[model samples]
Target: MKLLSVNLGTARPVPFTDHPDGVTGIDKRPADGPVRVAAPGPKGTGGSGLAGDTVCDLRHHGGADQAVYAFAREDLDAWERELGRPLANGCFGENLTTDGLDVSGALIGERWRVGSEVVLEVTSGRIPCRTFQGHLGEPGWVKRFTRKGVTGAYLRVIAPGAVQAGDPIEIVHRPGHGVTAATQFRAVTTERELLPGLLAAGDALHPEALAAARKHVARYGG
Candidate 1:
């Protein structure tokens, strides 16, 4: 697999976002060349792992566990066909637009060696938010997206390096757990019954999600 584009976003005013500032960086555009990738500190303090891109609302977005987001161009195309509109790379505000990867199907804790040096581990699936629905101008978009179960992928930086369009991606590792990004999304979203299984991903799971899973098991009994 390979990256179709590397996208960056600039903060801009939007009436649709729930952010206190009423601004968002969801309208990302493809970058011209290599963009540096690194862990962007902690959950609330860190922003985008990309140098130029910034995450406006840290309460719901941005963190080491979600330092970078990737979406499959194939999935975008599918959405384009369904929506009867043109969907460009980075339209989903993903940092990396991958051409051939099944991002949602990737197992949590799966490690990918991007380009040559950058390594990213899959941590979770992105949840559709009001900002995303408003940006897309799609009513009931959140439910539709959740129903589709193709919520892209959030990754944690494992090895810092630079990435750009056309860079090759290598699947360097896959944990023993079969819990996929989609499964994790479903567990926390529509299907609470699946929450107990997410423990198989162990520490590799996103901290927030891991905590939720533990809470679910404790309350409901695995």
Candidate 2:
């Protein structure tokens, strides 16, 4: 697989966002040169891992587990066919637009070596929220997206380094688990019964997701 483009965004007022500030960093555009990728901190404290990218809502966005968001070009094309509109590389607010990658099918904890140095692990799937629905301005978008169940993967930076457009993505590691990003998305969203099963992913599960799964197991005896 290859990185089609490295995108970054700046904070700006979004007309329909859920944030009190009415601001969002969803307007990502491809950037030139190698961008530094590192853990920004925790979920509520850090923003995007890409140095110049902005994360507007600290309470709901950004953190070590969600340092980078990636989406496949093929998925975007699918959306475009359904929406009857063209979607650009970074249009979905993803930091990395990848080509020839089955991002949603990737197993949790799978590690990708980007360029020559940066390594990132699959953590979870991007959950559709009010901000995302509002950004799209499509009626029933959240429900539509949820039903599609092809949510892109959120990545945690493992080895900080520089990443650029056209970088090759090598799968250097894959956890011995069947819990894929799509599975995690369903578990947390529509398929509550599947939550406990995500524990099989172990530490590869995002902290918030792990907590949710544990809570489900405690309540439902999974």
Candidate 3:
């Protein structure tokens, strides 16, 4: 129901892997803290900008597109145990780490205005890819995710501004259909064949996503 923390990342390769760069979160940062949210150098797409698009990996991998993974604030503890390291401010490999919000259940078309600066539109759910498996170092990670059904969402920047950790994330709006991020994630990843039902339930999807959903529906909806 509220913004816990806004996160961004530098595209650093895993210390010992051939995989691509990843993003993470910083915890316990104050609302007024200077949270970095975008790339400060040339983007992987050969451009330079301060937009989230500049730092996000969705543009490069075409997998977890536009999604800033939101985990339960408590998951940080679990991850610390799994990874054998202490979770730190800006260290969870997510763009945003939040509390008091069930991100897995956030509906499409939901929007949040952060501290009068950034506006986020929930577009779709985060679909796990091999990169995630690599990050977790678990071979069946993606399958476990599919079965667990706790995936988060992809959000677009409607209004860009400075954000920091511990900022109170407030919901601007919630759609009526109740097609939450978890349902959308499953529909897109597990039942990718049933995309129109999902898209139809979304209230404010971006043009590209809308078009893709329409095309998929046309192709699979028979």
Q: Return the top candidate by lDDT.
A: 1
The regions of model 1 sitting more than 4 angstroms off are none
Ranked candidates (TM-score, high to low): 1, 2, 3
Sum up the clashes in candidate 2.
Answer: 2
lDDT of 1 by residue, 38-134 (tens): 9999999999999899799999899899999999999999999999999989989999999779999999999999999999999999999999999
> Once superposed on the true structure, which residue ranges of model 3 sit more than 4 Å away at CA?
1-3, 15-32, 36-67, 74-92, 206-209, 220-222
Residue-by-residue lDDT tens digits, candidate 3, 88-189: 533434566677777778878887765567677776766666656665666787787687777666666666676666567888888887677777766666
Q: What is the lDDT of residue 185 in candidate 3?
A: 69
TM-score of model 1 relative to the true fold?
0.99
- Cα-based TM-score, every candidate: 0.99, 0.98, 0.70
**lDDT per residue as tens, model 2, 1-222:** 999999999989978887889899998999999999999998778988999999999898899999999999999999999999999989889999999999999999999999999999999999988778887788988999999999999999999999999999999998888999999999999999999999999988999999999999998889
lDDT of 3 at 184: 75
- lDDT per model, in order? 0.95, 0.94, 0.57
Clashing pairs for model 2 are 42-63, 43-63
Q: Please count the clashing residue pairs in each candidate, in the order shown.
A: 0, 2, 8
What is the lDDT for 217 in model 2? 92
